[model samples]
Target: MRRERVRRPSGAVPPSPFVRRGRPAGAQQDTEADPARAGTMGSKQIAQETFDEAVQENITEFEMEPEEAVREAVLQFESQGVDLSNIVKAVRPPASENGQRQKHQILLTLESLAGAVAERDAARLPQPLAALAAQCREQLALRCLAGRHGAYPAVLSACQLAAGDRQLLLQALAALAALLDGQPDLLDAAGRELLLRSLREQQDAEVTLAGIRCVRHACLKHEHNRQAFVQGGVLPVLTGAIARHGSAAELVRTAASALRVMTFDDDIRVPFGHAHDHAKMIVLENDGLRVLIEAAKAFTDNSAVLSELCATLSRLSVRNEFCQEIVDLGGLNFMVTLLADCMEHPDVVRQVLGAIRAVAGNDDVKDAIVEAGATELIVLAISHHLGQPQICEQGCAALCMLALRKPENCSVIMEGGGALAALQAMRAHPREVAVQKQACMLIRNLVSRSRELCGPILALGAEGLIAEARAAHRDCDDVARAALRDLGCKVELRELWTGQKGGLAQ
Candidate 1:
């Protein structure tokens, strides 16, 4: 008797030998449902299948869970009577109250493997190497969770292994990192290649972290690291990470470091918001500055990176040859926009103020920063409810710096109604005594540098000025004494009190 065949509820039917051998009319649609199988069976299937098979075989050996593999490997090493206590001792973090160090246990196992690998002791190495790679992969996976402490130590252990069993160890680390972690550490070609050669196998978020961190550290240590980044096929990878993994703090820091490295030379500087002008020498614009500018503007997860970039840009702006780029990138406008939104981030404000100070050293940039309402913002910052003493101090110093560059900015400060605020701050509180001293010094500088700045200082009224001078003189504070001398008090004004000389006209 003939029996009806069972079909999948989704309407899939079993394929006959002939149907599998030859493509049916609707075979393409059916195959599309199982993408992997369909690709292997299609026209390009021969090459695709070969490639996929190789990848799967590699992953099978390398992409296993790392922590378990490492523990097992360590136990196996100990079963063979290997002593790893000393290696563990060198790398152990400070012991806690319980005296039970879980990390030390893992580290001891990995270090044992590393030592065996380094000594070319094959019997002691293989199992531990395999376990180390697996632990790296497991740690990488854990990055999705909040606690990621054990990752770096594992990587260092793997790197040690890579130094010995070049082929086995390095390949193991790369496979594990690629599959399990997007960490910045293991992304560089040299680092990845090194890892790929020595590591047994595993994954880690730290692989990405390692790659970026290696590149960054190299840049910090010497110029050769920068060349390595360019030659290692890592730049595109790092830049791509920034675009796609913008949320990762490690990735963002890596991108900034890479950009900074490339920006060292004038030819590459144009890509990072800087260039060279015939007249002014260096100029950066649009995307060049925008990467960092956008980073600074993000203001949420990566504000530290933003602050660093801002400080770097500020330094660049102050270089006489680089001022043109600052102008071209709409820096003045950006600075103003940040002032309105970034009141909570004092570091950002400090950076913006510094950049302003740099660019504003030139008359045109100064006017632009001021015109962008920097003067008004400075006044607002001085009186912010948070009432940061440093903000007032910096505000006073920035005005002094601005007044030195453009006498008109001091007038803008006065017009923005900061004069009374500056005066009030001079005696705000005991904690604000330092700020008060800065205010008095700034007014003195304004009056001494140009009579025009004195117009506003005097506009605050003579009685208040005399009271400030008396406070400075009688307070026994060094800052107050210096400020008293700086207020343009003539010897005639001093000697009249002593009666050694006739009183001058009022």
Candidate 2:
């Protein structure tokens, strides 16, 4: 393949990678007249010109192996963070031309780079190799995006083992993944397919980690990418990635990060489209939560690992049946036990409390939870993390959910000093509407009847706080007003009835 170039006029400054948009090539002006500075700038420009010329010679000349010369040119381009866009465009075969020779040359170059990655797959790259690999990655990313010699599709095809030498397949796939990211419009389906395949079948932790990284980037800023991932069965592969490394923390962390992203989206499938949530069911039956539990246990000392595991579980516990699945998997008990053991770590406590709230929100689940002594843990979490409004909100919401129609649940809260916990949360976070609302709702449900639990709420003087915070939760003001009504004060219902007359009532 030959690279084309236009001859420059006299004294015309050549384009360098250091050239910025507004700054013309070699337009640098320095006020300082120091000879040292002038010498430095001159040396840099000379060195850059020397490097560019050498790269051009490598690409245009056929003296060396075509693949080796192309690889060397890429390394030179990457050393200075150079932009090969113009050079690539200048040299690329025309679309109308049947340039099989040029395309073949491009494929050879890709295979060479991929084989390098494979050579270093089993262990960390040495400094020199790591530098070369980083440069290779940066160059490949640019080349993939530049559409060189039909490079995009070629790179995509290289993901398959049968594309060429089987030894280089995983490396090629991994390299392609680093390029597929931030390109959802182009790579959503194809990228996800490649990633899922790599994660499920590769069995190499490096390949799985690479796939996990791609999954994170593909899902960035695109809902369609997430749908594509689920549609392509990313969850099953993710579980495979989690268990693939046999306790390698780096691989586990990467896989866990991918799981964290997978569960981050609140809407995995359309609500009314399927009764069973086929995608979620896939995750559940694959023992996804069980894998999370294992990760949480295996990485008890890693705050990041514990945090991601708890976050994934918290998201799963949003739905009713999933909450039960969490309990069945011992997730609820596991989280409470984690809180008891790691209260000093705020991140763990925050996620654990969030998960606990999500799991212990139903009538039956709350009963089992309170019976299992989660009520005390909830109160303790509230007390320990009062400065964390999210923790307080989840704790208070759990209390409200627990006491909804079960006075026995309210009795549990009262006996466990959860009423005081709610009061402390209200006082500490007076400005947080969520905390105030849940705290008020819990108190209202408690005093809604005489379950021998109203005394503690009344004794704590929660009525005024609940009433004052009524406007914070217009959606559930009835609960607040009812608590006031129960305290010998039938709060006005005029606004509650007629407030909807206005457009903003909703």
Candidate 3:
């Protein structure tokens, strides 16, 4: 079955694949001799207009052909020490019969190669297809246009027809990934099967990595494709990739990221998606939690891969049993050490904190996290990176989870100055609604079970901050009000209705 196309909202302009650099067309040019422009002129690259002007001069005055004139213009600019990296130094051919720019030569060549590969013998795949695939991999606009022109089946056909020729197979897979990057709906059933087959059967690390990349791009924002791959038993292949290639960091990282993307319900078109079910399958049926936790042992020194693994662990912790399972598998201790060791790396610390928070959904794991000395480390991480809003948000959230339902953990947070750190985060990131809300929620969780801690929290002017959050963000009203009420601050609790015999209480 074909995936349905998602339509953009009315009047919404599609994003251009090309990045326009340098001065815009018809903008006034600054001369190098201008006193104000001297310092900047040396760093500026040659604009397209200037390059075209020189080419015209070479053609008109020197009587050079267009192609030779273009070549001479490039040499002239290079001799003058002018950077020509951004200029498209080519002779502009006449427009086609339609009076528009011709289709990119690379895309035209890809189309031709697609037909040639399809018509050739199934046993002998042409080598030029691999060459064209390499070219398409470099240009995103060409990849996007190729997808629009129905290039997916041809590429998948090339991958299938490669017939164990590893290099050609790898290039074909890379081309498929580029085409599916933002155009995920182009991934049809045959493409999904090929992706799964490559990941499951291929023992080559490069081919496995390429197939994992294809899966990631295919599942990015397309819920339909995600479900299709999951139904095709991609979970086991993804987890097996890490186990099979344990020492390959790049392969493991890409596989972990692809697994995480399967649990994302980001596509608005598919409202009632199976993201939560997929997470459950990855953890419960496929033993994903244990696989990922064991994989973490190999990458203790690699902060980036560890961060991704931790993030995926958080995504897969969808149940109380999963949370407790992570702890039983020694995830909690590893996370605490990661937090303490990677204190200087904010990204790792943030994801580790998030994982801690997710697993802390289990009440016993909450106490375990605190006992591992994670509470103090979390507070210190927050204090160290007060300038980063994401760290502050995740740190506060982790503390909030640890303090939930366990008053003793609340005492630890207060002793570690968790309250003070959260309030400082709230104050530092006044414009960030997430920081404000999470800090407020932490306050309420801190003081919810222990009323006496409210005095110190209120003494830090939390009432004003919570009230400001309630006033500024509509979503924060209930939580902020609960915080205020628990802190012994007088807040207006409006009663919208009462149990009365009339039709409605107005």
* Shift in Å, residue 282, candidate 2: 3.4
| Candidate that beats the other on lDDT, 1 or 2, i.e. the better one | 2
lDDT of 1 at 6: 27
Better of 1 and 3 by lDDT: 3
lDDT of 1 by residue, 280-333 (tens): 121233233545555544544455666566565664553554555566666566
lDDT of 3 by residue, 1-506 (tens): 32332322323444322112221233333222211122345544544446666566566556678998888777755764665543456654435888764444555667676776769554444554655566556655455445545677777788887758888787778777876766677788878887888788889999999999999998988888898899899999999899889899999999999999999988766668898999999988889999998999999999988899999999998899999999999888889989989999989989998998899899998988888899999999999999999999999999999999889999999999999999999889988999999999999999999998999888988999999989999888999999999999999997877867578548
- Give lDDT: candidate 2, residue 412: 74
Clash number for every model? Answer: 49, 0, 0
What TM-score does model 2 achieve against the real structure? Answer: 0.61
For residue 424, give model 1's deviation from the true position in Å.
4.7
Root-mean-square deviation of every model: 23.9, 13.6, 12.1
Report the C-alpha lDDT of model 2 over 264-332, residue by residue, as the tens digit. Answer: 443333343321353365455667777777766677677767776777776666567777877777777
- Write down the TM-score of every candidate: 0.47, 0.61, 0.78
Strongest candidate by lDDT: 3
Query: In order, what lDDT does every prediction score?
Result: 0.49, 0.61, 0.80
Which scores greater on TM-score, model 1 or model 3?
A: 3
lDDT of 1 at 52: 24
